[model samples]
Target: MLIHHHKTLCVCDFTTLLELSQPKISRHLAQLREHGIVSDSRKGRWVYYSLNNQLPDWCQRVINETYQASQTELAELLNKSLTSESCCE
Candidate 1:
């Protein structure tokens, strides 16, 4: 969802959207990064994540399909975004 809407998102965004603990989110993100599904960049004290541009076209299509199939999940994320904490300056 983050990749779909914002293209990139800080760790805080995922924690806020999923209502999960930071450590758990970080762990999952680490796994995703390790698998080359996502990539990260550090800015000041925050790390932002986005879909890896190096991923195959088929993989990108799969992501888009998954996102499209997750309408309810995306609605939940949208609701969370309205009141979610942000790491943006």
Candidate 2:
């Protein structure tokens, strides 16, 4: 959901947006990275993650469909995130 909303995100962003622990967010991101569903790059002390642009067309389609199906809920979450104090900032 975060990826669908933001171009890129850090561990702090996930923790703040999802209200999850840093370790839990890191673990999930690591799995996505390992599966080639997401990619990461490090800058100084922070690691940023984004959806892999090279994902197969079918995979991208599935993601798009899923997002569309959950658009309302995801949008509400995004709005909440936007209103909250951003960890990235």
Candidate 3:
């Protein structure tokens, strides 16, 4: 749910999801990417990741529903994905 919310998302965003450290969030992303659950693309120094919508429809449904749940969480989710975390690391 968290991973896909920030489509074209990246590491710094995940950190805040679990209230985790950057390295920790990164590790999680690494794991997900390794499993083909997520994907990445380099934009200069930043790497953006998003759910591979090519996955089964069920998977996409779950992520989309989660993102649609609350406005605040959605805002935070996009912020983390587009920019780095707005606060301290």
Candidate 4:
């Protein structure tokens, strides 16, 4: 969903969007960061994550395609993210 929206999101946002705990979200994001799949930036107390633009074209294509294929199921989560307020605020 982050790839689809092309926006940065914080752990709190993922907690809200995915209905998961903050630690779980943070752990997954940390792993993604370690793998170079995502990049993070610290903004005050919040760390926001976005897809790594430096990814190879083939990797980008795969992520884009996966997002496309899952769009139907992800529609609700995407909508929720847009409409919901970030806890960071």
Query: What do the candidate models score in CA lDDT, each in turn?
Result: 0.83, 0.85, 0.66, 0.81
Superposed by TM-score, candidate 2 places the C-alpha of residue 85 at a distance from the truth, in angstroms, of 5.8
| TM-scores, all models, native as reference | 0.88, 0.87, 0.61, 0.88
Q: In candidate 4, how many Å is residue 8 off? A: 0.9
Ranking by lDDT: 2, 1, 4, 3
Question: Which pairs of residues collide in model 3?
Answer: none
lDDT of 4 at 4: 52
Tens-place lDDT per residue, model 1, 1-89, is 56766798887888777889999999998999999999999999889899899999999898889888998978877786624437554
Instruction: For candidate 4, give the lDDT of residue 60.
Output: 90
- Name the Cα RMSD for model 4: 1.6
Per-residue lDDT for 50 in model 2? Answer: 94
| Candidate 3 whole-model C-alpha lDDT, 0 to 1 | 0.66
Scanning candidate 1 in windows of ten residues, the lowest lDDT window is 80-89
**CA deviation > 4 Å runs, candidate 1:** 82-85
Give the top-scoring candidate (TM-score).
4
How does candidate 4 score on lDDT? Answer: 0.81
Error of 1 at 15 (Å): 1.1
Query: How well is each residue in 3-89 modelled by candidate 3, as lDDT tens digits?
Result: 554355556555555567988777877888898788888766777788776778887776677767766766765564434334422
Off by over 4 Å in 2: 82-89
**Superior candidate under TM-score, 2 versus 4:** 4
Alpha-carbon error at 36 in model 1, in Å? 0.5
